[model samples]
Target: MERIVCLLIFIIFNVVAQDEFIFWAELSNKNFILHHQNETISMAMTKSKNKTLEYACEITYVQNDFKEKMYDDFGVIAEEKMTKLDKFNFLNIHKNDLIDCFFNSKIDVKDFVKSEQTYVQSETYVRILPLRFVVEFHDNSAFIYYLK
Candidate 1:
């Protein structure tokens, strides 16, 4: 009985592993983010409720509650973008420059809120906005975003 159970388990595990490997291994090839203009797009790939990988892309310039919202917003949107990410890809935007935008999307917020009730959750302070910056969050997760 033990041997039979072990054999079944091994077979099931192998199948599951193969599926997961295929899913992840093909990500680089099939991911929409890979083909997008890296300079203007920022993507966050995360696992979904269905145990599938999902991604959210941000243009990075719009809705960034920065110091000067009006001027920046005008310059970015007039250029006709889904979101304002003009400044995020600036070559002059050094690592020291302070800029912020939510790297994760609204769907992520909704999912978080569903999990922990007390307060609404959001993907705030994702340090990957400025694109030129690399951040090591308190959770020891290091994120380096490339825009260009």
Candidate 2:
């Protein structure tokens, strides 16, 4: 009788394990899209701005021209098909990330840090973050953020 009871318990445990399922969160670039689960969170379109170590372009989804035409020496349409164009690329400057904005004319990190300006050399790739500073990338481009 004991042996029969043990076999029944083992079968029940195996069935319960088989019925269990797992869920996961989707990761793209620097964003995490989550769904409602016991161990996960649901992500929305507005949550794409969550702060993460990774970075990606937000405007990477552009469609190509769906129609194309070919011309011969006689200026006649030969073929029609889809065509693609070059993708646009831009820099993303977060509040914690370091940026080069040509804040100095000496091109020295020490000298720029000593001054009370929030500018740096655009050609240099440094990882120094300033405290509460503004960066003007172009004539009408200016942004303010904090350090890490």
Model 2: per-residue Cα lDDT at residue 7: 94
- Residue by residue across 21-78, what tens digits does model 2's lDDT show? 1112211121122222111211111211233222211222113311123234554322
Error of 2 at 138 (Å): 50
Candidate 2 clash total?
3
lDDT, residue 85, candidate 2 = 15
lDDT of 1: 0.28
How much is 4 displaced in model 2, in angstroms? 0.4
Off by over 4 Å in 1: 21-49, 55-148
TM-scores, all models, native as reference: 0.18, 0.14
The weakest ten consecutive residues by lDDT in model 1 span 20-29
Best by lDDT: 1
Each model's lDDT comes to 0.28, 0.24
* lDDT, model 2: 0.24
Q: At residue 102, give the lDDT of candidate 1.
A: 29
RMSD of 2: 21.1
